[model samples]
Target: MAGILVYAEVRNGAVRKASLEAVSEAARLTKELGGSVSAVLVGAAPANAGEVLGKAGASEVIALAGPKFTQYSGDGYAAAIHKVAAQMQPTAIFVASTPQGKDLAPQVAVLTHAGVASDCVGFTVAGGKLLAKRPVYAGKATLTVKAAESLLVATLRPNVFAQTDAGAPVAVTTREAGEVSLRAVVKEVLAAVANKLDVTEAPVVVSGGRGMKGPEHWGLLEALATAFGNAAVGASRAVVDAGWRPHDEQVGQTGKTVSPTLYIACGISGAIQHLAGMSSSRVIVAINKDPEAPIFKVADYGIVGDVFEVLPVLTEEVRRLRAAS
Candidate 1:
């Protein structure tokens, strides 16, 4: 049986949670295929990073390291991955559906002439072929795609699959990222102001909309997020378009798609476009004064009150609960 290869995305010398999810999924799939699971770590990685992947279920961890990989270069990284894939010739290659993964997956597919399924929520193998289930039509419909090539390449959406440990150590190997001709190089990376939590990776999200009135009123949402501790702040498309929040904070079909454990929609009248982004959330709580708001339709819990009047009370209650605990 051919092996499975997972691209373990690392940043700041640690593997990202999304890549760990991919690794876990790859391990599960490899068991079904009766093959071993291997992972490729690109760019600068910390020592013992392979052991981390081992615990996450990779039987073999390949570290591709060099000064050229210190920072991300799309062309260079894609070439390195292609070289590794050529060497391994695995049955399937899995990548996380992150900004970097989005850029890298297609390039590797194109280089290898392989069929690719992007933003896959789930997949299954049958008759020696891989089938992937993905969201389409603003996530209102599911599209199942089958890979025709010998190798299947796919990008798994973040937070969709749970990560698990394999309870054993694996072999680690290092390789030099040989020379590659690059078209563009990332000289500098400017990061946004760090938040307590990243919206995409957070388990809980507290979002506000135009009903918050103005940008000055965002403190209410922040206070609520603070009460949650692990929560991130999000914004509706209307507010984002109005320049009240950054594009990264926007949650909608036109912006970022999120699937958090709990989603709190404050003062948002859910539009189809907005719902398309967050409908996958496990639990939804909608707070809006209008009982007729569309958000109530999808909300597991609903609150009918003005956000200004409701938020402070909710924040205080949460703080009180935390204090008591």
Candidate 2:
């Protein structure tokens, strides 16, 4: 039927925002491509998963449940996804450009003999085929790609697409997670901080750089993040390398790429690698003492001041505004 098949990632019995974004994009594309949008849940999905995905525009949801699928096994999950793709033969498969999706997409592509477009930011229909627009060369260039074969596997970048709510409750078909060779199995999944939103998924990111001087100064960034309420704290590569911050908090080409509604860079010099990760942010505000810092080049608003001095005032102002509102 040439329908779009979306891989919906579930974490702690909830649908990940990135997965919802992928389903939403597929739903929009299906309008022009003339097919339905179906989602596949690859783990211990919640019973309401179908309704959640349906609200996100999926017409149907397939749940691959059972003990074997509870823990992530690359080989097992890939085989399961391949099994479904073979049965459905969707023209295009959409997956979120997450750590798991990055590994799963290539394996699925190989099994289905489909070309892959990783970390795609946009999509368009060209000649009845899906064309994916993705950033290349450290986000310096945009490349539009189409699958050579009939099927294409595209990974949609997080926070780049808007998730739309559409359609009614859809039927969810649960299937036993069949047997597959397990090369490596994830024994445990430990989050750095429970209940803390990942920087990639946060609407606002408050990042610190070498200018923070020491780990003790990070409290300023944290205070600011707390003031913003939904903001996540991020660190530059230099800060991570110096061991002042953890690698998970790093935001650069070597770290996690983020496209948030607002990105605040404090004491960051704006290295090209760091810029590559966050240049796509909707609005950027750079705060550095150096007036000549490269971060100013891409910032919508530049503040020339010491972060230590500015952050306290900024945090207080945000608190004041929130209190009044």
Candidate 3:
């Protein structure tokens, strides 16, 4: 009931960026909470993870190492996190709002008898208590909520919180998972195309809608994303419904919510549902033939032009700029 506990997620033996953001935010909150930050890394996290977490503001790193914790099973991961939270007895628990985190937060909350807040974009400490701000009504509005329970668990949206450097590296305390009864087991993980970024995690996302006409024309969108090098290809729900693009790439109310640094909407009319997913993006660029498209309203930059003619020039210009830099 003193410090903040962070569920530091690791992938490929490295900590995910979103988890670091959570830890950094927790560090900032410690001034008001008046306790150290404890980051718990579950499973087969690399040795350097503790150092990385320490630099990211973790006062101490807790390693839950064991064979059962290696692969992520919803039941197993939740059990492990609950055990750590129970032992630490932290005032607040923070988890990244990634796909894994979204599923894990509620389960952990239930185990620890805490109220769970999902996909929070902002936070404030009022009188030594945590207040979470989250998008409600499909991103149409923001609602500030305070958990009635003494222990509060919040899932922070990736890219929403700022990640900053903290103190130097700290000592890592190893812990055992002990015993867990898991109903399901993760035998293996099926990853997407190698090196391809998840839309939710990408820094830049170039999205297409039904205006792309058909799936064959997706190369125009891909070329633009490829030009940026770090950009990911996103699709609107309309295109996914039409089977023009895979559901994984869809960005909308029914799909994945993304808050990348830069979001470029190509040939998208910008339905409210689509806006609900990406309105939180730092900067938005919209391109469409119609000047009055809804996407232009939320866009920081707008290009009223045909996608066919604009995409090639934009791609080449991006490549030229990258080469020059």
Candidate 4:
């Protein structure tokens, strides 16, 4: 019967999907604890942020306005978060487990001396204490934990909680946007690659393991992704470390945890470290020449054959499906 604070992340004039999911999770937590959810943002006042958060199930929206927020400054964002938290005094706080959210939460936690939980899969309040489920040992094991006190901070993995419209009217208010000044400035941000799909936004991902042979043969994976149209190309830790692909494309226990609708594994051996990251996919397809590969155990569909041979057929089939559609 208290208030839980949810952080809203906005970029390119819209709220990020992960931020909405945080609101959704916050809404659920608040409902269980009999508390209201208040959404917080630190940016040039979002045009309709209040209504947007309300639609996403936020009972209240606290906008910390400052032009410096247009671009992410960790210190500024953290300082602003601390300011808002000190004012709201919510029983609990929730933040998305994004790159920025991970970077920003510690400042507030230190200020309030609240226990911080990162990369939590889910949460619940038990015996007046907050309990959380988090991945440990690079995702090999999931541990359930409880915060020492009610003042709590948490981060939720992306793609775990799908975003949906709250469908409720939200009231708007204006506040003084705080200033955060820094000596160093961002020069520029270059895209990973031209026309390359964003790893976080892809619905289907086709990843290559060490069996792909070498970097020169990456064309096979790219062609498959191209055939899928909306699919992104990903790589296993071995493939990335071997210089076959950028590190950003790596998906493993230490890398991004994705829940794509479909995932195609080419030449992957399915190390426990690798499976820990992608086991949550809705559907998994494996292509490996070795029948004994560990990946087949978790795959919904398994094709035992050379990826070099199977990939062309799969790519063609996907292309034909897209063409017919």
Candidate 5:
């Protein structure tokens, strides 16, 4: 039986950062439990992706190859993963809680009759059973759950776990994707891979709130994000609700909950609804003029000044810092 199976997420012919974190997180748990970490890559693992997974701590990478499985099909992915799970009979299975990962994990869980946990923030082993820790009630509470199945399945929250690369060597094995067939097929798969930083993978994020005024002023936010080099741009629920940004960029209870190392909230008031999303960030910097703003309560650092004025200065400072480095 395999020890732990991590679903390696690939996007647009490359390895997704969430998949790297998933394997790294799994490796930690597996080490704690005296087990192994095995990764599964569907839809023809891209070149070097298997190696990347290994570096993230996969003891073995099963790379499923073929064009038929190129696009993410729920049924096809479930069948493919089911095939591996049956053979591996792992103690735990980890999948990223992405749009695609969410769809596939549940289907595989049903097929394997494995208990499933979604958006687990933490995990551990006790009495040979896996325990998952997750937030609930819009991050108002935390819950610990134990799956009854021998093969435990969970969807890992992206960016929730800090990635620690152990540098495991690559060991890639291939399986034909044709072995798994879907009842439905996606006719086209297209992506715009340029000019966007994936927030789930970013170590630092600069998010804007209603203080930005309008979408036209979004250029300031973009410049700030660019100043940080790898930082992603996020939006408050108010901004999203106002159609100032896409739902995917929303960071709140009703949106994407992020746990980056650094979270910069510009013009955000830190409402409970919004705090539900980013309160877990390691270091929060609030750039709001209001000293009484609730966000300052949770912020590790606060700049009591107008964001409109502060942001431009901050952007220049970050630019200078990066240039210096």
Candidate 6:
């Protein structure tokens, strides 16, 4: 029987939000296209990984467990997913638009000779065909692409699709990981100092640019992020290139793209490349001394003041509100 297969990506022992979003999107597709929603869990998934995917609308969970699967191995993961796709004969395969997923999707497509749509923000089924909408030209335009081959593979962008409740647990199936010719393997992973939240996954992000004057002034932005409790710190390419922040903290076309619920830009001029990364944020607040700063054009609220002056007051106010609540 034809079904929809979702690659449920796990990070730091838990399933990634983008993967759940992909599964949720698959669940919706199943309702429209008349098929079952099955998920493949790779890596050292959490004990409740199956339950979590089930709640996200996966009717069947295929757990590929092994020591080699603990860390992300592109060739290994692609091989395992291709094997499952061959056995299940899924009509469409969904993967999240993450670093690992981006690598894995193309490999799976090459193996299956399936048509691929990358970084898709939305999906729809019509006349038994899968179509996807994705950003083009630095998100200035959206292109709707159709799958021409029998098998469809697409990577769903994070935070673009909304997740829905599936209401109950579904069946979980365990499968032994098949052996593949190993050319390369990840021996170890070095983690960075832990932040309260990953910038891509954070609901709220506080980002600063060159307006803060220098790296020494980063404490202001950090304080603001601390006030939000669940917020993550981000930086523009300028700050990152200037050695004021790590590249991981950078948000721009060359850095990580983010679509947080609330994005606060401090001392940023909002270059087009920078805007390309975070313009999709739900609510944007730009603080810059210059009213004509490009950031203000896209900001839902603009504050014309020095970031050093504005940040202290804003951070205190946020702390006060949180305490009151």
**On residues 203-303, what C-alpha lDDT tens digit does candidate 6 reach at each position?**
89999999989999999998999999989999999999999999988998899888898999999999989988898889999999998898998999999
For each of the candidates, give the backbone clash count. 0, 0, 1, 2, 0, 0
Please give the CA lDDT of all the candidate structures: 0.87, 0.90, 0.90, 0.80, 0.85, 0.87
Q: Any runs in candidate 6 off by more than 4 Å, and if so which?
A: none
After TM-score superposition, the amount by which residue 233's alpha carbon in candidate 1 deviates from its true location, in angstroms, is 0.3
- Which runs in model 3 stand beyond 4 Å of their true positions? none
Clashing pairs in 4: 55-166, 65-177
Count steric clashes of candidate 6. Answer: 0
- Cα lDDT of model 4 by residue, 133-232, tens digit: 9888866688898777668888877777766576475775556755666433344667767767766668899999999999988899889898987888
Model 3 whole-model lDDT (C-alpha atoms): 0.90
**Candidate 6 accuracy as lDDT:** 0.87
Model 5, 1-325: lDDT tens per residue?
A: 3578998888867777888888898888877676788899886778887678888988888987766775778888888888888888888889998878888899989988999999899897888678999888877788999986777789998877766777766868998755666787767755445657766667898999998788888888889988988899999989999998988889887887788889999998999889888888889999988899999999999999987898899999999988999
lDDT score, residue 130, model 5? 82
Colliding pairs, model 1: none
Error of 2 at 233 (Å): 0.5
Candidate 2 TM-score to native: 0.96
Per-residue CA lDDT of model 1 for 1-325, tens digit only, reads: 7578899888766888899889888888877776778889876666766777888888888888777777787788888888898988898889998888999899889987899999899888787667889999887799999887888889998888888886476766888979877777778866677534767889999999999999999999999999988899999999998999998899988888888999999989999999988988889999999999999999999999999999999999999999999
Candidate 2 lDDT over residue span 1-325, tens digit each:
6589999987777888999999988989988898888899877778788787998999989988656776887778878888888888898999998898998899889988899999999999977888999998887899999899999999998999989886677888988767777787789999988998799999999999999899999899999899989999999999999999999989989999999999999999998899989988999999999999999999999999999899999999999998899
- Per-model RMSD to reference: 1.6, 1.4, 1.3, 2.4, 2.0, 1.7
